[model samples]
Target: MTARTFQATNPATGQPLSPAFPVTTPQELASIVAAASEAARGFAASAPQLRADFLNAAAAGIEARAGELIAAAMGETGLPEARLRGEVGRTANQLRLFARVAAEGSWVDARIDHGDPSRKPLPKPDVRSLRVPLGPVAVFGASNFPLAFSVAGGDTASALAAGCPVVVKAHPAHPATSRLAAEAIQEAAAQVGLPAGVFGIIYEDGYELGVQLAQHPDIHAVGFTGSRTGGLALVAAAQARDVPIPVYAEMSSVNPSVFTQAALEAKAAALADGLAVSISGSGGQLCTQPGLLFVPVGQVGDEFLQQVAARLDATPACTLLTGGILKAYQQGAAGHLAKAGIQALTQGAATQIGAQPQLLGVPLAQFTAELADEVFGPISVAVRYEDLTEVTPVLAGLEGQLTATLHATDDELDGLSDLLHAMGTRAGRVVLNGFPTGVEVGHAMVHGGPFPATSDGGSSTSVGSRAIERFTRLRAYQDFPDRALPPELQDANPHGLWRLMDGERTR
Candidate 1:
């Protein structure tokens, strides 16, 4: 059976973009999954050097097509040229970083304990362990971050770096951008002489495709970034499979920011300005956007909110990613306004399809459980707390988040040691004094969190070199001969890696 085709649309002008993407038929999807499943063995067996080369080639391919990728992404996403260009650079850099990770080889976490037949009553057996690939992965391209989190995004890079094949399900909102990015990956794989199925891209707008992809026997793992409903759907599909797979879904967060009396007083103007950009930047589509902010009631009181309101009043209107996003934002904001204790501090002025930044406020007692919910567009709620005692409970009441922030002063830290601990416990990352919008891609970066923030179970990130670990699992070898042992575990140290030998660290 022939599947329908989906055309991309320009979010900026709501016009159709060229190069319609075809949805895969069940037969075709089966073929693609079969190819990837067949290719997974060879990909997992391929030398780390070869995989590194492929990643480097992929980086080069993306760099070579920077202009075209950025242009298409800008047109489809309605993001500024500068932002699109930066995203392309980030994507290319991320690929290179993973390439370095592949070449360095420490990502395998190889450890060897040599046979110690001497001391004890019983001799210890030689034991060696290292991580290995989990086979093919199904990566869901996110709509908001077309370049950085889509087709050739971190999920694919990490999966491939871990020696797993990847099949990308392109986001409908930016199908054109996804197609171009996927082409770069394909070309790079071909250049590196990797199997054609080592990387695959499928374009589909419906949930059926996603459900099938998740349920496919060949797909060993899943990676996704989107709304809670979408993420949960994938999770449900994967769980219902005969052999359930891990689905790393970065779903939703109300990344809450709490203000200290000192920090707010000192950085009030600056915080207002920075939060304004963070909340609305990229049409307020960022997963890390501060959705809820907390302020002390008695000390800062109405003055702090008024100051923030004035600054936001100056913030110019910007277009949201899509009409649906705008509508959701409007509905969410309207709901906040109608709630019992919440008041519309600053209502939006936008008549177009753009986001008119809005701020809602409620006293500590009246701040309901619903206030913690994230409004996807350029809107946030300010919760006023009476005392530090009330602060922790309110913060603890919110669900899991990607980030929780504290704008505490040096003097405040003494009083806030417990509060800071509480904030860090609830969030994946705790921001000390700055905004939570900008998430850096690094080894220590924890982009994933508990529950609704992510499906990773607070153990991994979709961003960083550590992300490669998610695509792999540990394999142990016991009592293996020197000649037959893998290079990473052999005494000759062919790979020259650091490992624990009989409890002593060695190279």
Candidate 2:
């Protein structure tokens, strides 16, 4: 009967940061989706360059308001100003990158096959295919990447670029930032002459509205970035629909890193510092954070653990993203410590909320069972192994991960090639001698994995140009005349881009 507003609270101070706006009810969500569906029809008919202009304008808007957005993100998320600023840069860069890719017009994978007049018995038919918008898309905001994975983030940008209207479900953790970003998108849409309903944000406190949106008949696809439980719930909801739609849900992972003997022997202390920063950076809130680490046994391994423990002791406990996240992190850390074979190698004294980082460690065997799970906060488990022989089995036991890192020297890489291959099979992306925290938004990055890592491995990342594929569908224009061909697939080559011709790659 009445609309309820969702409040945004400062994680650090436990104070109300801003007044809330009216939450979208199921009926409102339906109306929004309907409007988006209608807008998507007309938007899809517009030229690709026009869509590019909107994305470019959106990027400029985001950059102009970077200060306000970053401050609001920090105030609500308890993240440092520098981190928020960097995230804002990532968000804007992602939008611009998609804009460029969309403007290039090659991602559609347009193809044409000219009719063969001299066929054996029958004349060949002209065949053409191109990617089209799947229609209205429902995006679930991620708590971790408040800016880059939220309202004006990659999911929304790529979908819009692909000609799909986006209806975002705001994450409860950073409602203020979500609303601000939504306003930016709305302004950008208006400036670019796009329909107002092309982008909508539903600020619902409960998850039911999101469920309804996912199952809505008009919504052609769903893009999500969140926990396993939540992502799976959306997948189930989508499946229950009369005609199931694809749901691209990136869930949780314990992104594991391996340290070969040769590399550790060469730079044990340096690796220690790098791992500490990677594990503790952003309070270990990043999905790509190295949660499980496998180290080779011997003096080198012992030294690595000792250095890690010392660093853990020195580091202080920082406030998590929210009170709920903090509580969960504390419980997870305590549970691992209480396991039989596990020992708290080092435990930092808890600091005031939003003060400093928290660090903890456990033995290899116990951590294998107890700490393999993601705690989603500032914590990591050092799982030491006797040799490379034991690494595969340990990694094999891990759930799906967004990334797996191998710190190996040139000589060690040859011997560990099998292990790396196996890790690659299990993870969405494999890294060598690198931390996974700084995920580059490029063509090479694969930010999804199996099972709990993501619901659909085909569409995981919200960064880079690959993201546009999620919001598009392929359509074959059989026996179509040359005059009726889409602009990207016309014989005249209006876009002047590469395309596949009769199974052959060509321009």
Best by TM-score: 1
lDDT of 2 by residue, 422-466 (tens): 797789889989898988988767788877788886345656788
Q: Lowest lDDT 10-mer window, candidate 2?
A: 354-363
Screening candidate 1 with a backbone cut-off below 3 angstroms (N, C-alpha, C), the clashing residue pairs are none
> Which stretches in model 1 have alpha-carbon errors above 4 Å?
1-3, 117-121, 298-301, 349-352
Cand. 1 Cα-lDDT: 0.84
Question: For residue 433, what is the lDDT in candidate 1?
Answer: 82
Clashes, model 1: 0
Q: TM-score, each model?
A: 0.96, 0.96
